[model samples]
Target: MGDELTEETGHEARAPAEGEADRRPGRRALLVGGAAAALGTVLLAREELSHLWWRLPGVDHAREDGAVDYRGAQWIAASSANLRRADRPDDYRIDRVVVHVTQGSYRSAVNVFQDSSHRAAAHYVVRRDGHVAQMIRELDVAFHAGNRQYNERSVGIEHEGFVEKASSFTDAMYASSARLTAAICARYGMPVDRTHVIGHAEVPGADHTDPGRHWDWDRYMKLVRRARTALA
Candidate 1:
């Protein structure tokens, strides 16, 4: 009769405090299991983690031009070899725009920026077709200007083609580059005049004259002012 009662109840007729069994893991075991699982996940996702790095507060990886403007231009981040990180508006004040002429095709310029050996790049590159590519973020300094002071306090824009080729400075290039410059000026509180917006030739100790005589300052400034108004 007692055996029949035990079979029906699934337990012996005894005090649970004295006879109960504890099969569950303790707190230390649970913590160890969780840590092991987390480690496994990290190891499994190493390939994905390797492709990403810490970017500045304003960096937009989804952007093709790497800027928030979302104009037709896209962003392609330059390698670390061509740029260095800096806290903009806090550590450095970008008060000027330095224009340059790439002498080579836009593709060639991008290739050079990607190469560690070249050790040079700009914040933005305006192509002959008026398409823009932002290689470096505005918050960081690009190795564009020959002078350290100019590089530290200015945003460098490279126009596709050589200083000697007046034909490369197309109407579309002027308008697009002007719009970009206006946007930069607006963001940085810089004036769109020639004093604040200058050529690579204007830099102190600069040996090269790019965006030289062929670059129409009056037309570019007019376009820049108009673009800034439109953007506002």
Candidate 2:
């Protein structure tokens, strides 16, 4: 009877061992499923990150014209670039192009405009490499000139330079500014003449002085003329 009891006990233990072996495949399947889910999540995150860089909020599509959708641009704000519709009742007609120099690095100029304490702004900032950054919209006035009247009618473009001793603007910068100004003129139906395009120094006021003695007036005019012809 004791021998019989010992055999029964061994059989009971073997039954449980078989049951545990049967669970191994299920455990491996669960681990593989978890790894696949993790991989899928990583792929989804990568796609979302790419979209974040290129797409802007509120701008669903790009315009046919070269002009970027200001509403979607990351740098623009509702209070700064997005002037209320009531503020701009009339269509913006860009009559004059005012040239200025940042008197510092391109990065510095962007920082100043972003800083509220700096109390300075411009419609466009042209870099030494001829890269252009449009800070404010054409319709909204920038606080470039102390005089509001001039600011309202003129589009200010700040170049990277200190013009007192600098004899010439960078070739790239000059080319970019000329091209941009020509585009603005074409869009607004403005003439590309000296009267319409003036240096910051030429602005009527006692305080305004920029794109100073160092800037080459004749060379700049030639570039502007060339750009106008190309645009036309």
Candidate 3:
């Protein structure tokens, strides 16, 4: 009887151990599955947040003529001063469209514009990915050109292209800049000719050379013409 009782106790212990071993894989699988699910949720949330932050306003809908309103596009404001005039001229009379290339990243460009110590700014900064950032209002004079006289009459647009020969301006950036230039010209009654659209290098005694040699001026001009035609 003693031997039989001992054998029964051993069987009971072995049964529980076998059962626990069988459940181990399922428990581990559940833990791994839960971790995977959590990671996916986190990634999805991050994507949604990024979309919300970068999405531009008034560019999604189509008009009656099937044309979208690009002029109403808003950008992240980075200006430190309210240099804009409360009462602007009824007829927008911009004389020149000045093109530049930020020698840094889009974030860095905005930071420099915002930083008082830098004492540098531009009206607009166009990203390589085709994102537009407004540092100053159109009516306000941005401290872009060292010459205050030129700054007063010019609309400065800084493109995202590195000074290195390896870095090239993307198609999206060219397209976006053309569209932006067209909108500005239309609003301000500025001509789309080369005389009106000048590069930073062309500015007299400008002392800055940007939108470097890698930028395709011919392709950019073609897009600009297309945009002008569209506006017309």
For each candidate, the alpha-carbon lDDT, in order, equals 0.83, 0.69, 0.70
The per-residue C-alpha lDDT of model 1 at residue 17 equals 69
Candidate 3: residue pairs that collide: none
What clash pairs does model 1 have? 64-74, 64-75, 65-74, 65-75, 66-75
Candidate with more favorable, higher TM-score: 2 or 3: 3
RMSD of each: 18.2, 21.0, 20.5
Alpha-carbon deviation at 63 in model 2, angstroms: 12
Output the lDDT of residue 155, model 1.
89
lDDT of 1 at 142: 86
| Per-model TM against the reference | 0.70, 0.63, 0.63
For residues 1-232, write the lDDT of model 3, one tens digit per residue.
2333334456322234544554434777999999999999999898545534323565322223222224444455544552333111222246888999888788888777777677668778888888887666675566787676577677889887676643548878889999998888777788778898888888888887766677777787789889988889
Higher-lDDT candidate of 1 and 3: 1
lDDT of 2 by residue, 1-232 (tens): 2333334455333233544655434777999999999999999898545544434565333333335422222343223432212112133345888999888888888888877666668878888888787776675667786666677677888898787657337888887788888887776777888899888788777376788877877878788789889877
Give stretches of model 2 more than 4 Å off: 1-92
List the candidate numbers ranked by lDDT, top first: 1, 3, 2
Give me the candidate number with maximum lDDT: 1
Q: Over all chains combined, what TM-score does candidate 1 have?
A: 0.70
Residue-wise C-alpha lDDT for candidate 1, range 1-232, written one tens digit per residue? 5443454667665533656676557799999999999999998688434423334455423333346343666888788898877656555688999999999999999889989888889988999889999888776778899898789788889999988978989998999999999988899888779999999998999998898898898999999999999988
